[model samples]
Target: MWVLVLFDLPTETRKDRQVATRFRKSLLDDGFSMFQFSIYMRFCASRENADVHARRVKKSLPKHGKVCIMQITDKQFGMIELFHGQKEIEPEKPSQQLELF
Candidate 1:
């Protein structure tokens, strides 16, 4: 599964910028990688793990902004088509994770 965090936070004031920066930093600290300017994604081994991260994202959300969290199966994510200009590019493949009990 993949957890995608998309947000549009205000940055007009210094405090607003600080809050936006902190939110982005928190996402990175929580293992999400930048997919686009406003999109971050993290790969999870299960739905439960994804939910955990989603909750964390919610907890760190800015007071004034729009944020969206989405979960998609590996198959669905793999079907995404990317492009640079008019040239097509392959989407990144998810790394295999090893879990130990």
Candidate 2:
């Protein structure tokens, strides 16, 4: 299985950068690869590896920040790669639609 870990912090201050670096190192030590900024993709051999990595990351993040883990299938990974190859498209509408009677 593949796990995608995304993280967000309050700001990109020096302290935040340090924390992020440490977090990345920790993930690398646990055998995760960087997929994007603040996102890590890992190929886990078993559920135990994923669980351990999750727990370690949860414990390592700052109190003011957040980390999210999503398990992605091989098909999803391929879709992600395909999507990455194309330019981003804007939404059709700029404002929310309203209904009135």
- Which prediction has the highest lDDT against the true structure? 1
TM per prediction:
0.95, 0.67
Q: Which sections of candidate 2 miss by over 4 Å?
A: 83-101
Model 1 clash count equals 0
Taking every candidate in turn, the Cα RMSD to the unseen true structure, in Å, is: 0.9, 14.7
lDDT tens digits by residue: candidate 2, 49-93: 667777777777776778898876545555542234576533222
Which stretches of candidate 1 lie above 4 Å from their native place?
none
Best by TM-score: 1
Report the CA-based lDDT of candidate 1 relative to the real structure: 0.95
